[model samples]
Every structure is written in C-alpha cells, then in structure tokens.
Target: MTATTQPLHGRVDPAALPRHVSLADTVGQTMTMAWRATLKMRRNFEQFFDVTIQPLLFTAMFAGIFGGAISGSVDNYLPLLIPGLIGQTVLTACVATGTQLREDMDKGVFDRFKVLPISRIAPLAGPMVADMIRYFIAATLTFATGIAMGYRPGGGVVGVAAAILLAIVAGWSLAWIFTWFGTVGSSAQAVQGISLMVMFPLTFLSNAFVPTDTMPGWLQAFADINPVSHIISAIRDLANDGAVTAEVGWALLGCLAVIAIFAPLSVRGFTKKM
Candidate 1:
C-alpha cells in the first residue's frame, strides 16, 4: 500500500494520541465535565430543595432537642450546636453524590462516557466537583440559621468563613470515599444503604450531638478518636474561642489524610470498569 493509505511505520504521531492519557489533560477534561454538571444543577434549580430544606429542618430540630438537653437554652446552645450541625449536614450531603453516580451507571451514562476520548477520571471528578455545590448550600444555611438563633463566633467573620471553608473541603474529600462505593456497588439503593450505615454511626456517635466525655468508657474511647469529633471540635474552637488552635490543625490534617488515601484509589476505580 502507498504511504498515503499506509499506517505509520513504527512510531505513532504524538498529535493523534488521546488527551486523557496525560495528567494535565485529564484534569482539564475532568474540570470541564464537572463544569457541565454544575451548570445542569443551576438550570434545574428546584433540585436544590434538599440542600435548603434539610439544613433548615436539622438546625431547628437538633437545636431544640440536643441543644436543650445539653446546653439548656437556645441562647447558650446556638454557638456549640451550629458548628456541629454544619459538619453533620455537609457530611450527610455527600451520600447523594455517590447515589447519583450509581444512577448514572444504571442509565448507561458512564458506559457512554467510557467510550469517549475524554479522560476516564472526568466522570468521577465531575460528580465530586458538582457535589460541592450541595455542601456549600448546606454549610451556608447551617451557619445562617445559627446566626439567626443568636449564635455568633468569637473568631469573628473570618472564623465563620473558615468554618464554611472547612465544611467544603471536608465534604469534597469525603466524596472520594463514596465515589469508591459508587464504583463498586451494584445499585444506587445499595450505595445509599451502605453509606448510610457507615455515616450514621460515625456522625451520630461522635461529638456532633453530645460531648465525648459524657459517653461510656469504650464508646468514649471511640468518640475521642473519631475524625468527626475533631472536625466538630475545630469548628467549635474557631467559632467560640476565636483562636486557630491545635484542633483545627488536626482536623485539617485528618481531612488531607483522607484525600491522600482515597483520591488515587478513586481514580483507579473510575478508570477501570468493574
């Protein structure tokens, strides 16, 4: 055959290579996919009901129940409970993201994506990025509700801002864990069921609802070491004490640790079909 119709001798043209193979290209592709999903969320704005409603109901209920039980008055409990609510709400929103991923798989969206020239990581990264909006809404409403209930942080506006930032980062990082589940789980319901089983124990048993010191010996031991406790403590310290203390440092360190361990695993799971 003539060179015009012949395949290249031994070397393939670099320009012909798929962009997804490179790290920068993959990240850009992922971000673009994520951006598309974000725009979709904006267009279907009514879907934000959970983000808006859950925080409102939770802040009201938990503030009344746990707040009254622990701190005795809304006046005194708002500061402590609001930060805890922020952590709990953000963590809970993460589950929906994984469940959505399972839905996408069921509808063959992921199968279509896998056949495209786009980076394999794009599907997973896109959902993770899109899910941040949910976290942001939850955190914002939780903080706002706290303020309305007479909660003010000693760390001033900056502390309030940091608390929100922490919620976003923590929520984003934890999404990796659920992404792994979505990659492996058989169905959306299974993903939700598994995630809830784990999250309920983690969030409820920690300092989110009560102090660690009030627990039984074995339970207190678990609560002390729980990452959720650290996050809640950091938020409380920043909001109530106005100091960037060791708890914040440790909490951030824990979040980074989670990201480091799970991000690569998530990428691998996304790239290879189950």
Candidate 2:
C-alpha cells in the first residue's frame, strides 16, 4: 500500500486568532454594525410604523377621547397628555428592539456572527444605537401631533428639546432590559408578549393617562412608586415649565441604575448564547 500526502490549503490557525481588541477598534466595529442596522431599517420601511403612525394616531386618539373628561378642554390637557404620550410612545418603540433581536437569533443570524472577529457587544449594541432614531421619531411626532392639535408647550424650543432628549435616554436605557429578554426568549412573539406584560402596567398604572389621585388609594400608592411615573413627571416638568426638578434627577438616577444592572446581565446572557 502507498501512503498519500495532502498539501496544506491556507487555513488560519485557531490559536492565532485575536483574543482582545482595542477600544478604538471595538468602537469602529460597533459603528459598522450600527450602519448595517440602519440599512436594514431603510429596507424595512414598514418597521417605522410604531415610531411614526402610532405616535400620530395615539396622540390624536387619546387627546380627543380624554381631553374634555380629564381637564375640561383639549387645549388644557395637551400639557399633561403630550408628555405622557411621549413616554408611552418611546416605551412602545423600544419593544420592537427585543422582538427583532429575538427574530434575528431565531433565524440563526447570531450564529453567523459567531465566526466574525468582532466584539460580541457590537452586534448587540449596534442595533440598539440604531434604534435611537426610532425613539427620536416617536418623540418628535408626539410633539408635532400635540402642536397640530393646538397644544402649545410653555417650555419653548429648548425645553421641548430637553424633554425629547430625556425620553430618548430613558428609552435607550430601558431597551437594554428588553434586549436581555430577547437573548434568552424562545421566540420573537414571546419576547413581545412578555414586554407588553411588563409595559402595560408601567405605562397605564401610573400617572401617564390620569392623575394618580383619581385612582383608588392602593393603586395610587403603586403608581406613586412606579418608575414610569417618575419619567412622565420629569418629562412634564421639562415640557411645561422648562425646569429640571427632583423628578428629573430621580428619573436619570433610575436610568443609571437600570443600565448598571441590565447591561452586565445582557452581556453575560449574550456571551453564553454565543
């Protein structure tokens, strides 16, 4: 018997692969991934419905329905309604981030990412960063809808801008929690359903729609403690008075706490999946 020898085809050595990347390189890679996500959103234009159509529709619907009943006039209610709707819209917009992430994972997209030489956080953070555009859209449209409905803000342009900025920051911070859910969820639908379960109580049970005083004593107690209440109140303070109050500081502190907790959990969960 004759022994045959095979020639080595050019294959990379596994041991030679990079184990760590510089911060600059990681940031560059993250930006590249973010660009990819932006392109995806462009192609899937309908994905903007939550940020665009929902804001316009919900703002009109709520203002029309609750305007007279809540504050005696739509004009009078706009200040309260606008801020609350902005918070709700931004929070709802964030739900899509997790659903899409779950879908990508289900479709084995993350499997492809496993072979790439990039920071694992890039693929996760990129889509989140890109989703900020959606948050901004939701915030802007909510304000525009309020304006078109004769809801003038007292805070002027600077206060309105600050309010939008706060919503975006809070939305981005909350998205991390949902992103962690996406990493572990069984399906896209499951992630969305779970997110809604958590969001409905936060959005509705608080002072978003009605005054906490109007609610029952026990429910008012819960609403007072809810973090969503703090966010909506903070936004209202900025949009109505253009003042940064204790509520705004509390909202920001809550955001920082959320990031400090969920960011690490999300990274750990995601790495395990990889």
Candidate 3:
C-alpha cells in the first residue's frame, strides 16, 4: 500500500501520495491491523465482557422477566427470546466498534496509523475483522444460555449454527455505520451516546420480544420495516423452523446495503479526519 498522508487542512491529497497500492500489500496490512486490534482486545479483556457476560445476563433476565408475561412460560419464550437476544446482543456488540474507534482516535492511535504506509481502510476494517470474534462469542453464548434455560431449537445444531453465522455477518456490516460515527463524532462518549440512540429504537421497536400483532398499528408499521425485525425473523426461521426463509435473504441484503453505503463513507470520513 502506498504511504499516504492527510493534507494539513483537508482531505488526503492524492497528488502527494503514490498512485497505487498493490492488492496483496493491502490485504496483508489489513490483517496486520486486525492483529493490532486483537492485541488491544487482549490488553483490555473487558472488551470481551459485553459479548461474554451480556448474553448470559440478558438471556436470563429477559427470559425471567418476560417469559411468563410474553409467552406464558420461560421454556415457551425461548423459541422467541433466544433468537431475539441473538440479534440484540450482536447489535449491542457492534456499537462498541464505533465507540472504541473514537476512543482510539482521541488517543492518537489512528494518527500513527495515518503516517504508516498502510491502507486507509486497514485501520478501520481490521478492527472490524477482529470484532467478528466478539460477534461470534455473543451469538454462541446467547444460544448456550438459552439451551441451559431449557430452550431447545427445533432447527437443531445446523440451523443454530447458521443463525450464529448470520448474526456475525450482520454485526460486522452494522459496525461500519458506527465506524462512520467514530470518524465524525467529537468524542468517544458522544459517539457512544448517539450509537445507542439509534440502536435502542431499532432493537425495541422490532419483533425482538413480541410479535408485531400485539403492537399498535403505527408501531407495527415501523416494526415491519425494521432491519432488526428481518434479522430476528431470519434467525427464527433458521433456528426454530430450520428453514432458509425469505427473511434471511432480506436481512443479508440489508447487511450488504449497509456495507456498500457505510464502508466508503467510513473510509472517506477517516481519510478526511486524517
């Protein structure tokens, strides 16, 4: 990858940088950044806590609190609650990506990245790559916790596995939005607060805990269009019914759409910030 610098007052000046970066070097550098992210995760093991602990807590908490209220019993709710929690946990986990990126930028870590002959996206994409591990942990533990709570997925192991993979892909794609937030926000707390504002609505407004039929008409309309609703429905089809339903396709398309739009925006924003 060409060594590039952001011009002192504006966007990166391509005129000042080498014209090209080989694809191979780009891949290598991206992985190196992934490695760096992994190391940071190691130093701050608390990064894993959200993925590790939240699953257990949310699974138990939600099931205990809403099980009887929502489904008449905890075991009965697992079919709905487990899949919903997967989406919730994964969505919540990706929010940290943006928050941490903002924190890193505030600390000048990204400034060092800018000076190196590394790909601009490597610094952003690499951390996301490592974060896939976090997404996986969150999804898996949600399932494990549900199983411990007497929730048996009718789709069995293969179906549950597919749901987990989908959650990871969705989480990774969604993280790019937060990546953009990280690049533009004034501070880590600010970015974190904004990301949560977006996250909570999508999560709660969706069919995560209850069917849309129980919601008001206006709320139902929003839930019908909520990306999290599609994702949870897809997870339900895969994990509960063992069916690769249309919701899966829709959820994946949403992920691709988020990436296509946000990926470039994040890269450009990062470039400009540099």
Regions of model 1 farther than 4 Å from truth: 1-20
Q: Per-residue alpha-carbon lDDT of model 3 for 1-274, expressed as tens digits?
A: 8996655756554456654678998899889999999998999999999999999999999999999998999999999999899899998988999999999889888876665566778899999999999999999999999998899999999999999999999999999999999999999999999999999998999999999999999999999999999999999999998999999999999999999999999999998988
Per-residue alpha-carbon lDDT of candidate 1 for residues 154-268, written as tens digits (9 for 90 to 100): 8888887787788888889887888888877889999999989978888988988777888999999998898988988888887777678898899999999988987788767
Give lDDT per model, in order: 0.80, 0.89, 0.92
Tell me the TM-score of each prediction against the true structure.
Answer: 0.89, 0.92, 0.93
Best model per lDDT: 3
- The number of the candidate with the highest TM-score is 3
Off by over 4 Å in 2: 1-19
lDDT score for residue 41 of model 2: 97
Which residue pairs overlap in candidate 2's backbone?
none
Clashing pairs in 3: none
Write the number of the candidate with greater lDDT, choosing between 1 and 3.
Answer: 3
